[model samples]
Target: MTIFACMPVFCAIPTTYLSGSAAAGGTAVINSLALPGGFVSPAIMGWAKTTTGSFTSGLYMMAALLVAGGLAVLLGMPARTLQETR
Candidate 1:
């Protein structure tokens, strides 16, 4: 519940940057990629909490992952608008 609180923000990213069928594809790709993380995160968090006696370790791990993903998008994504690409 807490993890998914920002879902609306997540949903908006592809739509903002993409257009037409590309937007649909982008959304599909993003959600598909997130599927595994959705499954794994709870288990990992649970384990971390059990080990550390708190969720802080799991929260830090997730934060690190988010930061790494953001950096990846910044560096690897092409520097062009949808119109330019078209």
Candidate 2:
């Protein structure tokens, strides 16, 4: 679980930085500047109102979820292993 949780933290490093940059650049740059409704759409929707802060907050939540999901998977592995052992 610990290792799994850490994986998100590791993955988050780049995302965090990117999110910050996107936020600093504003929603126009984050959304319109990038691919047409490819990835920026979600970022814009998540950010809402095209604000850097909102985008950062949204990305933070996403990163946290990534960590949580990783942890869940990691934790589940042990349980599954134990079950098979039994």
Candidate 3:
């Protein structure tokens, strides 16, 4: 519920800032990558639950991945250089 609600808002952030081809390409790439995760994540969660006999470990792992993804976006995504801004 929360994830579904937040995803559109989060996706909107990039689209609001980017323009033209960059905006189109960026959203396209984001959607393309995210589409597969929908399938893959459930498989992972199911496997984790089967192996551990509970969802706790899988939830924790998902939380850890979320943290890692946030860190990657914060630290790894390059800021626009002055040359590009002009």
Candidate 4:
């Protein structure tokens, strides 16, 4: 729920610098790439639960991945103004 709530803000991060066909193509590519993870992660979480016989580990793993993603955004993603990208 929180993830979906925050998606618009995150989505805006990329869209702000793109326009016209570039923006459309970039959005298409981003959705295409992101789709697989949406499918794969639940299966991975289910596997983790099955092997461990508890959902705790799976939840922890999800939390860890969330932290890693946050860190990636903070450390790896470069801050660029709209003018910079263009």
Candidate 5:
């Protein structure tokens, strides 16, 4: 769960930094090619200027939360059934 929760923060740090660097130089990195031109181009430029970072980071964070929550639910299931039996 801890790892799951931290995955977003981990991915975000590098993604934000690299995007900012690319935008500042007005050059695209190979990874940036995967990003949508209309949406991500403007977003990366905005993030570079504002230092606010990527929406993808937020997505990663949400995914981490979901993974952590799912793990928690799975871990609790056995206890839940035990209580029901009692």
Candidate 6:
């Protein structure tokens, strides 16, 4: 369900900054960027669990990254893009 919502936003990114035609390539780039984190996140979480005996620190770190990414999108994207998306 979240993927349903996320893909359009994913597409919107390139459409916003570049062009509608760039979306497919942009999505490929975005997916590739996400690949590293997907691999690294679980290992980091596992390390946190082993070293700290809990997932709290790992979860907090992920949450912080989420907030930072959202902020970067909000600040970096053009104001008109926000209005058009709505």
What global local distance difference test value does model 6 have? 0.78
lDDT of each: 0.82, 0.54, 0.78, 0.77, 0.53, 0.78
Candidate 3 shows a clash count of: 0
Tens digit per residue, CA lDDT, model 5, 25-72: 433342364355458556555665556455665456556655775576
Q: At residue 77, give the lDDT of candidate 2.
A: 53
lDDT of 1 by residue, 1-86 (tens): 74467668667878887899999999999889989997889998999999999999999988888778767765765668534757
What TM-score quantifies how close candidate 1 is to the native fold? 0.65
TM-score, predicted candidate 4 vs. hidden true structure: 0.76
**lDDT (Cα) of model 4:** 0.77
Q: Give the C-alpha miss distance for residue 81 in model 2, angstroms.
A: 4.2
Q: Quick one: best lDDT, which candidate?
A: 1
How do the residues 53-81 of candidate 6 rate in per-residue lDDT, one tens digit apiece?
99999888777877787788789878886
What TM-score goes with each of the models?
A: 0.65, 0.34, 0.75, 0.76, 0.32, 0.74
What clash count goes with each model? Answer: 0, 1, 0, 0, 0, 0
At residue 1, give the lDDT of candidate 4: 88
Please identify which of the two predictions, 1 or 5, would achieve the higher lDDT against the true structure. Answer: 1
Residue pairs clashing, model 2? 23-52
As a whole number from 0 to 100, the lDDT of residue 73 in candidate 2 is 48
lDDT per residue as tens, model 4, 23-71: 8887787789779988878987899989999988988888888788768
lDDT by residue (tens digit), candidate 2, 4-25 = 5564554443443357666455
Query: Which ranges of candidate 2 are over 4 A from the true structure?
Result: 1-53, 79-86
Clashing pairs in 5: none
lDDT of 3 by residue, 1-86 (tens): 76677678668756766998898888998899889988988988999999999999988888787777767665754566324656
Comparing 2 and 5 by TM-score, which wins? Answer: 2
